[model samples]
Target: MSASVRAVIFDVGETLLDDSTFWGSWADWLGVPRHTLAVLVGVVTTQGRDNAEALRLIKPGFDLVAERAARERAGHGESITDADLYPDARPTLGALRDAGFWVGIAGNQTERAGLLLRALELPVDAIATSDEWNVAKPDSRFFERLCTWSGHRADQIVYVGDHRDNDIIAAHSAGLHTAHIRRGPWGYQNADDPKLRATATWRINELTELPALLISSDTG
Candidate 1:
């Protein structure tokens, strides 16, 4: 698998940064109650896979997250910017680039993820925003677009992200290898499910672990 891979893609939000404190603060400032907020966390961390149908059960929280995003923007006059990525992420990306992996973003996200990437100040192949695609991960077209843009076959690339269903599922459907970043509540929500793990060709925590994970199947 390592020999075949030429590139790697990443999901930006919770997979990369500790976004809970920021999002939680936003929720409280926007007046969402704690219980409703917990359900909203479920929808977002799980990524509203059921979406409109999930709305039937979580309508209030869904609307609440949306409303909070709106309120935070109004109250602060802008969304979050320059979020701190976990430690060693910058060096890890540099190492992957050094190893000739065409690194990039492959999942859905917020405006802040861009700023985080910019802060890294390294060259990556591209950042495919699922927000722009208007279709999040687990959708084949999203992965297809990534493969097309990177000019590689599905098997030639790897999709790394936080969500089991969206990023890994979409990458698998596209025939790419998957790297599941098992961290925080996000990974916890889906880790116990075997079907989710099946999509990930690799699973990891620290970004610094990625280069070796991508390049060294020789580990014994």
Candidate 2:
């Protein structure tokens, strides 16, 4: 890790979790084809809209909280499990800690999602969610809370995530270094945007690349 960058914080959804099952389950609940929902997600997100708008487009005034309760009642509650983690998540996180870097997970997730992450017992030092803080990404307050929670200055943290707006641009605006990982839908779509790409301190395809990148960054 770079001496100047003392901590590495991550965004939860595409940064660590695959999130395919989350959306797939929602598609099943809505009785729509998975591909249909996937396509709509891409469309909405590409247009600078929230991914949840896809669900709203399918069903007007879709209340996520209400639907979540309905799913739980039907024994189909949303979940996050080991299977949702990308193969590189564990190894990379463990490596960062082993190398003596403070690590944390903070993102626009429900409080339930934060609890689920803690249940997994990853090697991170902290785990937080939007609901837990009463704030979400693209909102500067979210990153402000993250900086405080991590006990690191804005420049001392490298915020890694998949989304351009929420992860790269927002983190940068908050004065933290940003890593835009190229994976999930948002990852691939924004990867090609030169302006967005330039905003990131680093671009990587896998979490496994971070340690080496950060280590070598100081020398470069």
Candidate 3:
């Protein structure tokens, strides 16, 4: 572990969970073909567009609550579970905790997401969400709340995620070490952006690489 780092916080979505299937489910509920939705999502992501903008382009005035209710009525939204988590997530978190680092999750997610993650029983000391904090990432308050929750100095914390702006750049600006994990549409898109890439303290392909990087930092 890095001697300077006392805590490691992570973003949700593509950081710990693979949400492609979840989005596909949403597409199905919206009566759009999966392939069509995939192409549209990919196009927008590649163009560095936000999810809300992409959704508006696909279906104007998209109501998440209504769509979710409709999907539930049709028996679709119940498919996603802890099974969506990446294979490396559990082991990496466990290793970090066992190595004596305070591990937590702080991300732009709904309140239900925190409960869902708790059900997964991941080895985390703390978990928080935008819904609970009432502030989303890229905002200074979000990072401040995360630091408060982790009980660590900003410089002694590491924030890891797949999003460039929401995770790496934002966390870096708040004085935390940042790791960019290349996966998912956002990760792939931002991976090619030199400005985003430059903000990352570490760029890794998988979560399993984190423990070793922390160890190396200790020695370095």
Candidate 4:
């Protein structure tokens, strides 16, 4: 870890947010069993395909945007609730801010998700989404926007997330430090891959470990 790091940005889904309800809600909308959708999500993940592919597998040529709109009209829209957060999420983020790090949340989530997160009033300096910025992760432009929003240079920021490709690899490639949190599906799966493990500056088991990692890195 670099002493130059001054900010910590987190991914939303599966990092701070549990996301089980997110998927289950989709299953309910599609009239499929939650377990069936869950299994399909796992299959897509193992294949390194987009998780949205699971929805497409259920209904070919699925227009995600249209479907989301239709769901809203039908009063079955995506929702975010307090229970969707990992228990450690708020405390860790608050701890980091208390320790004097500029903290933010940015992820490949929709504008609605962004608004919902802001509504929760998370102790963050900023909260942004791909939909809000019109760019998504693994896209260099997205990281550029993150750096800009963070008010710090890329190298001076440490991004934390669960995905190897979208979070660690992509953030590292953008010249930012990365912490891989091993909690969610992608987290558990990537933790087993030695090469992917090597890509992150640090690996942690939970969000609570982050403040200590940053503090020790500063002191060490």
lDDT of 2 by residue, 87-190 (tens): 99999999999988999999998888998999999999999999999999899999999889999999999999999989999999999999999999899988
How far is 113's C-alpha from truth in model 1 (Å)?
5.0
Candidate order by TM-score, highest to lowest? Answer: 4, 2, 3, 1
- All models: lDDT? 0.67, 0.92, 0.84, 0.91
**CA lDDT, candidate 3, residue 71:** 64
lDDT of 4 by residue, 109-220 (tens): 9999998999999998999999999999999999999988888999899989999999999998999889999987899998967766777988999899888888778522
lDDT (tens digit, per residue) of candidate 1 on 1-220: 2778988877776666666555565456556665565566677556645433333353444574475467656774223343556665557667888898888765665454455455556557676566666666666888888888788888888888777777777678789888887776667777666877787887786777888877886321
Model 3 score (lDDT): 0.84
Clash count, one per candidate: 0, 0, 0, 0
Candidate 3 lDDT tens digits, 113-190 = 777778888899988889888999899889988888899989999999999888999999999999999998888877
Segments of candidate 3 deviating more than 4 angstroms: 65-80, 218-220
Estimate candidate 3's RMSD in Å: 2.1
Error of 2 at 49 (Å): 1.5
Model 2, position 170, has a per-residue lDDT of 92
